[model samples]
Target: MNTVATPSEVTKGKHQIDLIDGSFTASEAQDLVVPMLTKKINFHQIKRMSLFEKNHKDTCAPDRDRILELEEAKATVEDIFLQAKIEGKKVKMHSTIHITLED
Candidate 1:
């Protein structure tokens, strides 16, 4: 039988299941310590962070370091777009401009 698991299950070595298939499960932080004591599994705190998290602590990075990350994201997007365009898929980016009136 297909079972659905919350992120906690994954970190805990429990049954495997896909959440995309329509199972609802939630994880709590309190459950983690039992596995830490008995399971001997190595787990990091990153799983606790939301998928959409953008940690801004990187401003401390040197000037060149940040630009390299920006450039890589740009290159990856450009490569995917070029392939999509060649495959006859429609790719469009919409933008809006805001105007400010003089006081």
Candidate 2:
């Protein structure tokens, strides 16, 4: 396997992000936009990592009718990473991966 630079939050099952090799191609960067970030937050990061964004009660839709919006947002994030193949840029889990897991 290529030398992996996992992020602080990478774990075996807690979550996983299967991303494209952006370094291999730049056009693939467009694949990083998750649908939820665009439909809800109106912006999504171009990344290929299993990073989770806690949904703030305050930012939820004012309509208050879309209970699934959060999950959809998460799916969108997942889609962006998966389709883009943009795995975490650098190696992770080698440093303080659990230095603050309890915090």
Backbone clashes in candidate 1 total: 0
Q: Per-residue CA lDDT of candidate 1, range 1-103, in tens?
A: 7667576654553242222222111221113222332322111123223221565443423333444554555455556555655675544433243333333
Lowest-lDDT window of 10 residues in candidate 2? 91-100
Error of 2 at 14 (Å): 35
User: Candidate 1, residue 98: CA error in Å?
Assistant: 10
- Report the Cα lDDT for candidate 2: 0.39
- Highest TM-score among the candidates is held by which one? 1
Q: Residue by residue across 21-47, what tens digits does model 2's lDDT show?
A: 324222333333344235543322212
- Backbone clashes per model, in order? 0, 9
> Where is model 2 more than 4 Å wrong at Cα?
1-66, 86-103
Compared with the true structure, model 2 gives a TM-score of 0.22
Using all chains and alpha carbons, the TM-scores for the candidates as numbered come to 0.29, 0.22
